[model samples]
Target: MWFVKVHQNVKFHARETTALRTWVPGLGGAGPRLVAADPALLAVVVTAVEGRPLHGAVLTGAEEEAVFRSLGVLAGRIHAGPPSPSPTAVAPVTRADRYAKVDRHLEAARPHLAPGDEEHVRAVVEQAVVLEPLPLVVTHGDFQIRNILLAAGGSLRVVDFERSAPQPVVRDLVRLPDHFDGREDLRRAFFDGYGRLFTALEQAHLATEAVLDAVSGIGYGTAHGDPELVERGRRILARSRAGTLCPAPTPPAGGNPS
Candidate 1:
C-alpha cells in the first residue's frame, strides 16, 4: 500500500474517522482506498487522482464552465442524500458556538485590526447570531477546491469531510467559491445543479442562508489575525450584506457589486 502522508494530524481523530466512513464509499476509483480505522493515524488512503491543484492555474473559459457544472452536479447528489438519524446524527454547529470561537481569535489579535475595522467586525459577529437557521442536511463541512480531487477519467472526488455534519445545504454551496476567490459563474452552475435536485424555494432559501452562515464564519476566521485573511473576510462580509454573495450575479473583477 503506497503511503502519502499529506500533513500532520491537525483535525481530531474522531472527526477524521467519521469523515472517511461517510465520504470514501461515495467516491469513484479503483485502488487508492481509504484505510479503515488505521491505528497509525486518521487519514484517508485513496488511489491518488491525477490533476494538479486548481490554484494559480486559471481555468480556460470552457474548462471553467465545465468545472462549475461538474461541481454543481456532484454537490447536488451529496446534498440529496438523507440525513443520518439523531443518534448517529451530524448536528449543525450553532451561531453562538461559532461566535465564541471567533471572539477568542479576535481577542488574541486585537492589536492587528484597524479601529474602524474592529467595530465593523463586531457588528458582523452580532448580526450573525440572529440570522434565521436552516433545515439540517448532510453538509461537506469543508468543501473547497483543495479538497476536490479530479481523476484521470474526468471523475471528481471530494475529500476531507472531517467537518462533515448536518448543516443547511447552503453551507456546502458557500465553500465551493471560496477556493476560487468567489467565482460567481461557478457558483451559478453549482446552484443550477442543486436546483434540479432541490426545486422548492424553501429548500433553496435554507441553503442560501446556510451559505451566509459559512461566509460569516470564514470572515471571522480570516479577520482574526492575518492581514490577507482580514481583507478577504471584509470582502466576503460586504458582498454578503449587499445580497450579492450566493446565487447572485458575479461581481466585477475587483469590486463588490452591491
Candidate 2:
C-alpha cells in the first residue's frame, strides 16, 4: 500500500523529505518507507502502514499505560542514533536560535491570550533562555499521540515527519506533560520505557519549550480554524501559569534574573 503526501510549504516538504531519507533508516521500519519524492511538486509517496492513530481511542487503565510505555520506547528509538545531516537546514540547533522561534510564535499568539497571560509567558521564556544547554538529538518534532498509530497486534508506527529536526532532547517532551495531565503513573511508565531519566538541564528546559509549543499551537490553530489545538495550547499555558509547567525562575547564583 502507498500514500501520497502533498505539502503546501516548501520548507515542510524539504524537512519531511530530508528527515525521512536520513533519519528513517535508524527507525527500524517503524516509520513510513519513502517511495518517491517530487521536489518541484512538493509531494512524496510513501508506503502506507495499517493502523489508526492513538488519539481519541478509549482504553482501560492498563491499556493506556501499556500504550504510553510503548510510545516512550518508540520515541527512544527515534532519538537513539547519532545525529544525521540534512540536505536542507532546519533551525540551527542552539538555545539562542530556539528562542527566536518563541518570538515568532508569540507575536502571532499574543492577541489570543487572556490579557495578563502574555506577561507570564514572556517571564517564563526569559528564565528558560538562560538555562544550561541541553543535549541535542534528532527529534520527532511533533511527538504527540495523534501521530502515533496502533496496529491490531499492538505494534506502533509513528508517522508525520514534516516537523522533524535536530533539537534539544527536551523539545520532544513538550507535549507529553500536558498529555499525561498530571498522571504520574503514565509518566513513570513512559520514562521507564524510554530507559533514562531527564537530565537537570532537560528538565529545566522543558517549560520554555512548552511555551514555544503552546504559542505555536494557538497561533496555527487560530489561523487554521482548529479550536481543538487552540484549546490544547490554552491548557498548556494554564499549566504554566499555575506553576506546574513553568514556575518562577530561581535567582541565578548571587545575581538577579534580569
Candidate 3:
C-alpha cells in the first residue's frame, strides 16, 4: 500500500521519499518499507503499516507504562543506530542552527504575530542561542504522538520519515510525551527504557523547541492558508510567553499521553 503525502512543495516530497528509500532498509520493524518514489507525482509508495495511530490507541493504565517503556527502548535503539548514507543526506544541525531556523520562521510569521509576541520571540531567541552543542543522532524529525502507530502484537511502527535527518538527540527527544511532569511513573518508565535520566537542562530545552515549532507552524500556515494551524501557532506563542508551553501538563486519570 502507498502512504502518499502531498505537500505544497515538491522538494519536500522528493526529499522525504528519498529519505525513506534510503533509510527504510535499516529501520527494520521500526518503520515502513519503502517501495518507490515518484517525484513527478510528488508521491511516495511504501508497504502498508497495518496498525493504528498511537493518538487513538487503547494504551492506558499498566499498558500505558509498558508502551512508553517500549517506546523509550525503541528510541534508544534507533538513536544508537548509524546515520543514513544518502547522497543528499541532511547533516546534523547545531543549537545555533536551530535558533537560526526559528528566527527565519518567526520572521516570516511576524505580520501574523501580535507585537508583544514578536518581542517575546526576540527575547526567547536571545536566551535560546546560548545553548551548548550536543552529540548528533539520526532524528525522526517529527516524532510527535501522531506519527506513531501500534502495529500487530502491540509493536510500534513510526511513520513519516520525510523530515528525518541528523540532529541532536535532544531534537528527537523533544517529540516524545515525557513533558507531563506530575506523571512521574510514565516519565520514569520512558527514561528507564532509554537508559537515560531525565535531566534538568534537557527538560528546560523543550520550551525553546516548542516556541520554534510554533513559529514554524505559523509560517507554514500563513503561507498555505491553513487557519487552524495558524490559530494553533498563535496559541503556542501565547503560552511560551506566559511560561506555560512546557508547564507540567495536567495528568490524566490514567496518567498517559499516547
Candidate 4:
C-alpha cells in the first residue's frame, strides 16, 4: 500500500523527494520507497512500512543495544553512499554553510536568551567553526529514537525524509546525546555496527552542533509553548556550558564501511 504525504512548504517537499530518491537504496529496505512525487502539488506517495515509533518502548538492555546497532548500520549505509544524480539534489554542506545556519539560529535564540548568554554561545561556536571541514554525508537531520519504527519482528525502520540533507556526519548525532550520554556500551555497539568511530574533531563538532540545537530548541519551544522541550533545551545548554555535552573524541578506530 501507499502512504501519501502532503507538505506545506515546497522546499521540504523537494528535500524529502530528493533524499528518498537519492539515498533509499542504501537503506536496504529500512526506508520507504518513493512511489510518485508532484512538485507542483507539494505531495508524494511512498510505499508504507508497518511499525510503531520506537521511543518509550520497553526493551531489555540487549534488545535496546541491538536496536541502536541496527540504526547505526542504516545510518552508515546511507552516509557512505553517493547523493542523487538528479540536478535538484540537495547541495553538500560546508563548515561555512553550517556556521551560517548556526548564526541564523543564534539570532532566533538571542531574544529568548538571558543577558550575556548569546555572547557565551557565540564564543563556543566560534571555537568549533575554526576546525577543519569534515566529509559530508546524507544525514537524516533528526536522528532521535522517536523517529525510528520497530516492526513486530524486531526490525527497525526509519521514517520521515523532509529534513534529510547532505551534512557533516556528526550532524546526525546532534539529537543522540541523550541516548549515549552515560552509556558507553551502547555507544560502542552502535559504532561497531557503523564500522567507524567519531574522531576528536568530529566529537568537538558534535558538541558544537548540540549547543546550537539546544538554543534553537529553547527559542522554538518558548515561542510555541512547549515547556518540556524548553526544559530539555535548558538541560542540554547546561551540559554544554559544563563541557560535557559530548564525550572527548578518541583515536580513530577504522574507516567507514563500504
Candidate with best TM-score: 2
Clashes of 3: 0
Q: Which stretches of candidate 1 lie over 4 Å from their true place?
A: 4-11, 30-32, 39-44, 85-92, 108-115, 176-184, 196-231, 238-243, 247-258
lDDT of 2 by residue, 1-258 (tens): 999999989878977888888887678668898999998999999988678878898888988888878888988988885575554467546777667787778788888998777888779888886777766788888888888888887778888889887876778888888866766668766776776666556767887788778888999999999998899899988888877873322332453333
The total of clashing pairs for model 1 equals 5
Clashing pairs in 2: none
For residue 158, give model 1's deviation from the true position in Å: 1.7
Clashing pairs in 1: 32-46, 32-47, 33-45, 90-166, 170-207
- Order of quality (TM-score): 2, 4, 3, 1
Off by over 4 Å in 2: 86-93, 246-258
- Per-residue CA lDDT of model 3 for 1-258, tens digit only, reads 666656556656754665576655566877887677676777767877877888757656787777777778777876776665465645555677677676689778988998798778778878866766556666777876678888777778888776667776667665343333345677667766777653445556766776777788789989999876688678778777777556443334554432
For residues 1-258, write the lDDT of model 1, one tens digit per residue. 444434345444444455456644554451135554553654444445456555444667767767777777777677765565245434466555556665565564455444454555566566555566656776676666667766555556675556777666656655444434555566555555454433344333533344344435445655565455455555555554455544444433554333
Model with the higher lDDT, candidate 1 or 3? 3
For model 4, how does the per-residue alpha-carbon lDDT over 87-174 read when each residue is reduced to its tens digit? 5566665677666776677776776666666776888888986788777677887887878999888788888888777788888888
lDDT of 3: 0.69
**Candidate 3 clashing pairs, residues 3+ apart or interchain:** none
Q: Which whole-number lDDT from 0 to 100 does residue 148 have in model 4?
A: 90
Give per-candidate clash totals: 5, 0, 0, 0
